[model samples]
Target: MPDYKKNSISLTGAVGLGTGVMISAGIFALLGQVAELSGSWFPLIFIIGSIVTAFSAYSYVKMSQEYPSAGGIGMFLVKAYGKGTITASAALMMAVSMIINQSLVARTFGTYTLQLFDGAQTEWLVPLLGVGLIVVSFLINISGNTFIQTFTSIASLIKIIGLSTMAIAGIIVADFAFTIPNKASNPPDIGIVSSVAAIALTILAFKGFTTITNSGEEITKPKKNVGRAITISILVSLSVYLLLAWAVSSNLTLSEIIAAKDYALAEAARPAFGDFGVWFTVILAIIATITGIIASVFAVSRMLAMLTEMKLIPHKHFHMPGSIQKHTLVYTVVLAIVLTVSFDLTRIASIGAILYLVMDIMIHWGVFRHLRKKVNANPFIVVSAIVLDLIVLSAFLWVKFQSDIVVVVVAILMITFIFIGEYAFLRKTSD
Candidate 1:
């Protein structure tokens, strides 16, 4: 019996925003990395991961119905398990993780936007523009939910138009067989490592469903709609990922994809429609990034508010003064700091990915165990999901361990805050 509005998101709005939110992170970015990691098995890994994520969608959908609140992972953890402090702290981490993930993706969108500007330093200019976007989005968010929702709907449409155009052109023009690894890797050396690394990065593409859970409170029909939203949105996004992988992999040699990879959407489109391809993708990336920034900052701030509700954080530092409009600025400002400081999508994405997977595992096991008490389900399915989640997580860690110091530090800093918040503050509050 929450006092919140019951007019949940329509299936249409949910699916559209879900798709808009996911496409930018997954397709515009992750393909090249996955291509490198999966080696000959790139397509296989994605197909497999998509299946799990699809189920992951179902699992969370169930959790959403059981605990219908805006808290998302926090609600799932605290309500189901009655471990308020732990989940409250976890909610804080989820908030930061969303900021990192969203800002990184938005900045990448910035990178693509700079391509549209002549005489612009694509590298630095992209991040600077991303900073500007974060600022603008903050103002929009603090304005009100009506503004955020309306704006996101428009952003989603822009994304659909841009991505749909690419997908259509690719299917008609590109050949999948060309990119499919014809021969199995006889003995892929350190290349195997790269493929695994790619899985971690690419997982970010499939990472948007959880955000729907963040807005669970707003959903018109929590049980029915939220589940459908999470599942359908992910399935929709994953289908495109498969299409893009085939489209990009099918048409271009791995080396060529790598060479023209950042602009892979444009590169893929070139064969189908030369010169027009560049503008087409540039337009899509811009639309996708703008919406992603809006959707993400709004969602993350709501998640932080959940922490306050449970007394995990003092309500004052993070309070929603009116209908979520109050905290959007705070979330946007944090996003600005991350984007302006760096366009290290890889590191920020990595840390975000790790937190997401860890949260997924916690919720996955938490819910499955709860169900086991009442009814029987396959241990194998649960075990397999767990194993695959680890494999995905391990692949990420393996690559992350070797490459960057900063990625490790940022992840550690975020994690350290979670632990301290849980043991020190959450514990004291409970006592």
Candidate 2:
């Protein structure tokens, strides 16, 4: 049996756990892409992304109140449908998305780290850094949550402090680059669509509630704290994101920014703080991303643990403790291999972001569907949730359809693998 602890974390800790796990992508890197997409509408994009995500967070709280457990959205999807292949597929995706998300961060961290020094290419530096991050976090996992939780708390603090410091620094030292009123624009084209998609990409920076779910075994007050932490985490993360967007946008012209393209935060910081700014951000990125990697390693390990227990995966793989802990280390090493081999942080984060969005939407969609039919909750509320989620799904699919054919194919292949894996598991169990 799993040794469960009650309220090991305060309600505040639950919220911090979510924000801590997810906010690395949102803050340390993403300004350049967001600025490019929003054009003159960066502020609007930030607010819109926050509003939509706020609703999604609310859905999570509502669902958590109903079915709180460490299983995350996997459990939510499973219980709603009475458990089947669809549930199996959902859990598999969640498990993979968590892996993909961390890889994206690990890659980003490596890239940013190498960039700190002159004539250094973040391209190669990032991969090695990614492997190192996996190794470090894996060690943290073995000590158990007693150590892991405290370390994660520190990582969470680094993220907030770094971002806040950057925002404040930008305000004090960096120039405010606001859009001129009444800038003429044309009808939206593929260029525009891609740009909006990029801004939507900014939303990915704030997605990390699963870390809290993965830590479910450690959480003391599961029901109350899970929902509480998720909500607070998203809100705090959003606030930081909004501040970042504003800081970066304030430092460059809509046109100079769109032209300069990538890493606007670094470029913006360079002018105001000069050498101080660049070095500070580089160090900050390293610290913030290290924190993110730890959070990611923890989340994926637990998700794997849950899937193994549910019989959807081979029983031997779930590392509960002792022998099981090795599974977490193995998963960490596998992610390191993926991260070390990959150089393109944007593409990596892009694929990860899209896959995660699909899972999040599906998780919420399953909840809404269940509440509407089985629970017979308020039709009006349920309809609103469904309608809003439909908008999110449409946006997600539309963007995915336009950008990468690989993501779509990969998603299908992943689902295929899940069924095959599950089928093989059942066969072994019967024997």
Candidate 3:
């Protein structure tokens, strides 16, 4: 067994890790998608999303304070459900969702980078760039903890400053007024259902805070700093996301935003700062996506490795390895690459949102039903988290069903497969 590198990550590093994932391609890619669903008032969706995520974070923060471990949510699930199918499947779902996010960010990297080049053939170029990014991130992960922390921290700072500057500048250029330029093709009025559905993506955008919990044991003060890091990261992310939403909405009309949904940030830059602004936004996207993948792969591979140690999941070295962590790193990057090549951004985001929300509900329930007392959690907050997730998830599924039945079907099948497969594995292992 390799050292878990306890006390290796400082609180600042943990915040960097969390915001690295949270601030990444999320704002860059998902803004337009959320706008498409919620219309002109998409920025409000982020506010609502943050409220729901704050409730969800309560379960995780309480759990980490009580039982901090390198295993993170995997450990939390096991404590609540024991070493059973529910524990294994939900943990796997969370792991897969994180990997799905990696692919989404990687693809966003490709999309934003190509904005610098006109008439680039996205058919091959996008996935090619995405795969290249995953490989680079994998190499960075193998360099160990100190470098990863340093790199992500610096990258996080750069993107935050850059994004904040761009957002403020765009808002100023728009003179603090946001209106759809093309009234003829104005977006439809946002309804209750649409607004709720848009929260799913905003939730997904904020979900990066979970990366902090995953690295709980590595932080300097596991019990105290873990919760603090989660809180600070969420608050920071909320501020940045709101600025970004307003900035983009101010610059681009609903139609323009939807058309350039994948590269909306760069598109938003054009009306404000012209080609130079586009270049600046693209550079920031590159930094955010790269650091996002680095931090995510770090936390996710560790979580999966912990599951293997618990024998909750099977593993194979296949004649190559330095440690279980290394093997899992390889596995994590491979899965991300596969998904990057296979799915479009919309499908990837949808699938990730569904998986994450379902797993989030399970975590809240686990704490609410079983560990709430032990962890000293508030029952009202836990129940509110569950209810909010259910509402947003139900709305998201209904909207996807109406527009893209394939995304909903794929999510259901993936959940089914994870649960069924984990049950068989646990049953066989017990036997």
In terms of lDDT, which candidate is strongest? Answer: 3
Between candidates 1 and 3, the TM-score winner: 3
Q: How many pairs of residues collide in each model?
A: 6, 14, 0
lDDT, candidate 3, 1-431, per-residue tens:
26589999999999999999999878999998998888867888899999999999999999999989888999999999999999999999999999999999999999988998876474879999999999999999999899999999999999999999999999899898865445444566557797789999999999998998888888998999999999999999999998988899888888899899999999999998999999999999999999999999999999999999999998988999488989999999999999999999999999999999999999999999999899999999999999999999999998899889999999999999999999999999999
Off by over 4 Å in 3: 178-184
Cand. 2 TM to true fold: 0.86
Tens-place lDDT digits, model 2, residues 224-276 = 77766776777778777777667766676665655433345566677667877
Off by over 4 Å in 1: 1-4, 83-85, 118-122, 175-178, 181-193, 315-325, 370-380, 428-431
What C-alpha lDDT does candidate 3 achieve relative to the native structure?
0.93
If both were scored by lDDT, which would come out higher, candidate 2 or candidate 3? Answer: 3
> Candidate 1, residues 114-223: lDDT per residue as tens digits?
65655736466666776787777777766655566677777776676667657756766754244463444222443665665666665677777777887788877877
List the global CA lDDT of all models.
0.67, 0.63, 0.93
On TM-score, who's better, 2 or 3? 3
Which of 1 and 2 is the better model by TM-score? 1
